[model samples]
Target: MARTATHSPARVDGPPAGPIEIDVRTRVFTWITDRVGVIAISRMSAEDLARARSRRLSHNVVTSRVFGPMPEDVSLTDLRIAGPDGPLTLRLYRPHGPLPAGRHPDEGLPVVVNFHGGGGSLGNLDQSDWLCAHVAARVGALVVSVDYRLAPEHPYPAARDDGYAALCWAVRHAEALGGRADRVAVMGDSAGGNLAAVVCLLAREAGPVIDAQVLLYPVVDLTFDAPSTTAFERGPMLTRADMDVFRTNYLGEGGDASDPFCSPLRAPDHRDLPPALVITAMVDPLHDDGVAYAERLRDAGVPTRHSDHARAVHGFICFPGVCRAAGEALAEICEELAARLA
Candidate 1:
């Protein structure tokens, strides 16, 4: 088993309270996107939602620029695995380069299983190419990015089940994927972050030991009652109205928001989970969700680190080119994963 680090008191790092200061480049980027009406899923019709998903916004030229190109030192391959509902597509990332002297190709490398942020409805594997590839190269880990089933058509539990299934698959095939089975981590952003947290909780009671978790601007609570949800209700990127749409689409008619699997923040106990690095954006309505989750984990004696980026907006990490804080947060993520997985 990978060594578990000592529990650390949850400490938040960011600017003191004041008006939120979004980065200038971020301001300009949002202005252009808003003018173009890039994606307002809250206002989109069912047909429009289907069209948007088909477009795969995350792989477009503009998004490629914003999210940064896939690192040259990483190679990618797509494969299918059995998920709870059906077959699921997964993108595997491996670093380019020979093994270190005296080290076997399959030895010591860590594994990172990633889920992309799409509010349980919107994203795909292509959206996570940059982050997964970079982590593969930077941390010398095999990065498996899951293309989980979406909501409305699939609804509640579908995405979450796919997430846990992928994590189990990654661990089961770690050696074949050129990674150590014992050194594994789960990572995601936004709704994907919610999945990552839920996966860790599931693994704690079941099996497949996860060493670490990285949640970027995660939506841990579906209650939508966090103070930040009201404070930044009209987000520059992710608005409260948009969240309502996501909730309705993901939960469908009778889904429960308070379910521990749906809202990991509402879990009965947060103890015995993997260590975590929760990143939050000051301008995001889900900001308090990350803050509160980190506190819950820390209070439960789980090693946790909370980072609040003052100049970032919701999903800023996906727009690294425009968000300076994205790069800084990426460094923090890489460093944390490296240490925990090592």
Candidate 2:
């Protein structure tokens, strides 16, 4: 089986509140990241960064508490399927909760098709194991995390296509996976967040309808010129340059930034999409991405919920052990998903 899984110095709660309230600890951690990025990683060549990332992943999957063994009630499995480009992987998480005696994964449970954040270039199945476990255990819904193709090679539509394929696969094989085809939702963080939204948009033509979408600090706008992007130029984890790297890597040269396939916020119509829960951290450069998307979702008559974790930064979902806010946010997101899916 495979598994999955912010910063912040502020709350991305879009309204009813005033300015950006920075979290002192989040500021400290982000300042440290900024320093580290300056002193080391920022200077590395892309090839070197890839090498370093692989090395880190080797240790992260083992040492990360998020990647640790699943809860006693949760089970995991790793599987592969045919895709446009060779074989694609999916890590499935199932919880032994209150399923009817005759029902099993081979029968069906509510399912969430998850895509991970890594700017569409760096994430893999193992990176999401922890989140998958927590989601499966907490929600009692089958969690299927897709390992889609990355960018700088695969480019814009590749990840999107792969994501769509995974959704179709999840829906078509839902009964066999013990998941309900009618209750499948799409969720992602960052780049994956972008994909989650794109999948919903793309599904307007595709056969398997998406039930809902959960976007966490997604890259809704590839333009990366939003006010929040400028304000959070130097991040706790994501910087303006970091976004440049992600955007350029994902789109490559001369790709249309305005293409809704690449930037969901740029999408002309938010009208008939599934309900959405948009989560953002006040300190993240992409915070406005979630906020803007939610605003439009509401404007277009989509049932939507927006939450800003005060005193947080981007990527908090990966650091539950270090930040109490991260753990709380993760639990809250899972709860919302469970309720919506139910």
- Across 100-141, the per-residue lDDT of candidate 2 in tens digits comes to 334454555789999988777676676677677788887778
Instruction: Give the Å error, residue 173, model 1.
Output: 1.4
300: Cα error in model 2, Å? 0.7
Q: Please provide, for model 1 over 1-342, each residue's C-alpha lDDT reduced to its tens digit, 9 standing for 90 to 100.
A: 011223322323322467867778899988786666556678778897888788754456766678786677788899999999789999999888654345466476889999999898788787788888888887888899999999889998889889999899989988777788999999999999999999999999998999999999898889988777878787788778889989988999899999989999899999999999988887888877788788889898888988878778888888878888877888889989988987
Clashes of 1: 0
The candidate 1 region of ten consecutive residues with least summed lDDT is: 1-10
Q: TM-score of every model?
A: 0.92, 0.86
